[model samples]
Each structure stands twice: as structure tokens, then as C-alpha cells.
Target: MTTIDDLPIRDDLRGQTPYGAPQLDVAVRLNTNEHAFAVPQPVIEEMRKRLDAELSDLNRYPDRDAVALRTDLAAYLGHGLGFASVWAANGSNEVQQQLLQAFGGPGRTALGFGPSYSMHPLLAAGTGTRWIGSLRDPDFGLRADAAVAEIHRHDPDLVFLCSPNNPTGTALDPAVIDAVLGAARGMVIVDEAYFEYARSGTRSAISLLPGHPRLVVTRTMSKAFGFAGGRLGYFAADPAVVDAVQLVRLPYHLSALTQAAARAAVAQSAALLATVEQIKVQRDRIVDTFRGRGVQVADSDANFVLFRTADDQKAVWQAFLDRGVLIRDVGLAGWLRVTAGTETETTAFLTAAEEIL
Candidate 1:
């Protein structure tokens, strides 16, 4: 009967918890911020065809650089973004890890605004980089001036800015990104995992990558493209920045099957990505429903909403679970998060919430 204490692990990781949200068995699950829609049938058919084409090559290694996939990703991003400026891996978490591995480690630090994607700090920790939790406005928003001040104060090796931030569901103002890029001495990584679901006018930091070699905008197919199961995440940066991650990433990190499926999905982008608008609609509906009942709901640009539980947060979470709907308790004392699921799923969540409250 050996325990972790007996096995001799890294001193820093001895007591640290792994990053995860609860994956429970429930009828309506809006907990993980995953797109409620599955990949459309046409895209699935396209993938099956592409995968079948790759069967003969399974014995061989995939392209280590994933060049074709990178090319398609570049075309998909389309801000005059080219293949050389993009990088991909299993998921956005791996992309962040590779960035941290390249830029952050022993004696280095990474800073993030609090209540953002929790993984920012955890990823930094896993890479042995110090993590800094900076202050955000009471409403979980980051102002440009304050962000600049914090960057100056910490002067970290890497700064993570999560747009349409998780658990809080708010987008960072472009001004804040500008100020941080101007003031920070290290690389700035903007996590845009929910970019596709943002409001119509939400500006992406991808547009800022031209002259700023240190700025990286990471995105995922998990949310909007309904490719979470496909596990594809990528980032757009200066080609030099893209090259730096290559020095740290595992060789041939993406498999042929993944590349094939993602390429097919991108090819049929219109069909697979058609659900974004509908998800946004459901998101707005959830926000309205909660607010109509006098609950404090955060304005979300992502596919999820964060609402205040105020008192008895755990009890409320349990009540929703008991009713067969699952939501996220983001450890924010008085707040919980629910993803913007499909119309029926959204209605189930609302009805369960109404009954619970």
C-alpha cells in the first residue's frame, strides 16, 4: 500500500491539485463549457472518408510539422494569417503548456487576472513557473490602466489574458491587451478559447500579431466547431514565436487521424459551425431567465454565463445536480457557471433552475 508521499514526487507538486471540472452523470449537463451540438452529419461523413484515406498510412508516422493541417488552420483564421504563423497541439491546454515550456520555467513567472481560466495558473505551475493572480474589477473585468500597472509590478516572463474569460464569462477590453503589450517585458498569450461565440463586434487579439512578436492568440475548435472530442487547439503568433514552441513540443504531437478529421471539419466549416448563432441565442436566453428571476448574472460574450449563488452556493449546485442538470462551481464563493447548450438542453437547465430556486 504505497501512497503518493512514499513515491517521491516533485516537491512543488506534493500538495497541488490537478485542474478539472466535475464530470457527472446527468440528463442535462452544462458544466464543462463544451458546445452542446455534435459535429454535423455531413462533416462526420467527410471525416470518415478522410480517415479511410489514411488507413494505409497508419503504420507510418504523421508529418511531424503537421504542415497541411497548419495550412488549413491558417486559411480558417484568415486575417492574412499564414501557415508559418500558426501552431497546433492536442488542445489549448497543451498549446499553453508548450508556450510555458518555451518561455516560463524555473525562476520565471506568469501573470493572469484572477477568476480567469483556472488553467492559466495550473499550467504555469506544471511547468515550474511562478504564477501571479492579478486583480480584476469587482465585476471580474480588467481595465487597461490597472492591467498595465500589474504588468509593471510583476514583470512576469509570460502573461495570460483570457478573453471572454471562463467562470466569469466577460471579455477583456482591447485597450487592456494594447496596454499589456506595450508595458509587459515578456510574451503575452491571449486565450481565445471561446472567440467564435463572442458577440458580433468583439474584436480578437489576432489582429494585433503583425508587429508584436510576443503576442499569441490561442483558439480552439472545441467550443464553436463542436470538435472538443477531436482535441484540436491552435495559436496564431509571429512566425518566430511559432518557431520557438517547436523547440519544446513533443515530436509529431498530433496524430494522422486528428489531422484528417480536423481538416475535414474545417473544409465543411459552414455546416459544422452553423450552430454558433443558436448557441449565442441560448446563452442570451439563459442570462435573461436568470436575471428575470432577480439572480445576478454576468454579461457573457462566451457560450456560458456565470450567475451569483450568493448564499448556499454548494447547496444550489447540489440541488441542480439532483434535478439532473450539471453546472460548474468555479470556486468563486458566490458564483457558478453554466454553458449555453442546445435549445432543449438550455430549456431543461432553466426549468430545473426555476424549480430549484
Candidate 2:
């Protein structure tokens, strides 16, 4: 009998941990940047109503292209961002993969700014593409000069920009992003997974799509739309680019149930907007609380706050866990990230931090 180790594996995946969020059981969980609220009753009822209608079709495969959902998504985006075209996947993660499949492959490179989303490199690896992470400045802002120079040097096939980025929770400057875009010879994918939580007037690269054929902006319902478990995300790009993603996507990827659920959520955008407002309030309060206690916090435009602690980051994480709180220990060595939850949970997190710090 052959031992398992004797079997050949993909050379690229010899020692890789696939992309995933942390899983932990804690009373006041703030680790994964999930929305602190549930889908509103009206949205739930609407979903149930649509599901009732679609249950008859469960015996068959879902619409291969999810055309109706796409139309609804376009309408939803038009209402929110004043843009009318959109495409989607099971989650933004899948959308990201579709992007790689379209524009990146073996020998081509996927470039990303450092301390941004962790998924870019992992996805690139899985696609047999080279991944390059360029470090940002100490404040987590993109170094426009270095980035432009590197883009010219590497000439990557794809570049990922996570605005109001993860872990550090900072947005890339519009001017800097524009410079990189100008210098890039390939597709630029901007992940706006935290858009709703960002302050008003924060610029979105989506607005620049008309002039940039190589740009795509991806958004997720998991963060601000309170649909993490529902696993829905969408992207807006040039129709040609959207067509490229359509080519690589699996058949019937979005189930009828998921379509119903997403449609329901989109139909009730007002409620989601209200909840986003509340989360922003809580987020601002958390940032203030951390600053008052002398904890250096990143100026976040997302629903989470990242702070630096002089104490051992691992020790701080353990202390929070020991106190029934759960927060993400980002790889920044001395930094940790906590999501904005309900008022009570935020208070508990503060209390736990007070003890841990």
C-alpha cells in the first residue's frame, strides 16, 4: 500500500493553508468583521415568500447565469452607487478567484499592496500565478511612488486594491490609487468589502470605471449588508471583463435559495442602511474609547478598528479569549483587530481590553 505522502500533489500547494477566517466560540465575538445585526424581519419574510415560490424549482438546477439576480443586483447598485452594471458569485472570495482565472495564470503575476486583504496572495497561489506583496508605508497607506515604480517593473497581469482595507482598516488615497492605475498595464481589482461603513465622501474607484477599461470594483454583502452566512458578493466592471468572469464560473453557482435571499436583502436596502449607520456609530465610539486609553488605533473606514498594543499581541488575544471575547490577531506583530458589534458586546470588549492591556 502506498503511503499518503507518496502521492503527488500540486507543487504550488506543498505547504499552504487555504484562505479562511478564524473560527472560535466566544461570547462577544469581534474577530472576523461580521455584521453585528441580523436580517430584518421584512427581509426575512420577503425571502421566505420568494423561497416559497421557487421551492418548486429546487428539483432542477438554479439558473446557470443567475440572470434575474444580476438584473436585481444592477438595480440595487444603481440605487446605492449610481452605477447600473453588476456581476456576482457565492461570495466575494469566489469573485476574486474568477478574476484570477480571467486575467492571471501561470507565469503571470498578481500584485497587491501589503497589510491589505490576505486573500489576494492565497488566491494567486491557487491559480498557479506568481504573487507579490509590496509593503505599504508605516501608517498603512500606499507608497504611490514605490507602487508606480514596481508596477512598471513587474508589469503584473492583475493588481488588487482593498479600499478601507482589512486588518489595518485604512483606505488607499485616491490620488495614489489613480497613479497606480495609470502606471498599471493590467487589470486593477478594487475590493470594497467595507464600503458602507466608510465615512461619507470617501472616494470609490468604481466612479473611475468609465475611463479605465482595466478596472473592477467588488463588493460584499457579508460585511455591511448583514449576510455573511448568506455568502453573496458582486462586482462591477466593463462588460467585457464581466464576460470574462462568466466564462470561468461554474454552472448554476448561485442557488435559487441564495438568489431569493439576496434579492430580499437588496429589496430592503433601507433597513440595511439604517443598521450600517448604527454600526458606524459603534465603530466611532470604539475608536474613541481605544484612543482615550492611549491605545494607538488605525483610522479605519470600515466596521472594525485595528489597534496597536505594547503588550505581546498573542498574550492580549489569549486574555481576550480567556475573558469570553474573541478578536483577530493580525500578523502585524503588535496589532489586533476587533469588529464593531452590538453596544453591549462593544462594552464587554472594552472591558476585556482594559484588563488585557
lDDT of each: 0.91, 0.86
Which regions of candidate 2 are displaced past 4 Å?
1-6, 79-84
Q: Write the per-residue lDDT of candidate 2 for residues 42-97, one digit (tens) a residue.
A: 88888899889989879999877777887877776663432235788988999999
Poorest lDDT segment (10 consecutive residues) of candidate 2: 76-85
Model 1 bad stretches (over 4 Å):
none
Report residue 119 deviation for candidate 2 (angstroms). 1.0
lDDT per residue, candidate 1, 1-357, as tens digits? 998888879998998777788887889989999988887788889999999999999999999999999999999999998899999999899999999999999999999998898888889889999999987899888899899899888898899999989878899888889889999999999999998889988999998888899999999988888899999999999999888999999998999999999999889998977889999999999998889899999989999999988578898999899989999988888788999998999999998888876
lDDT at 195, model 1: 89
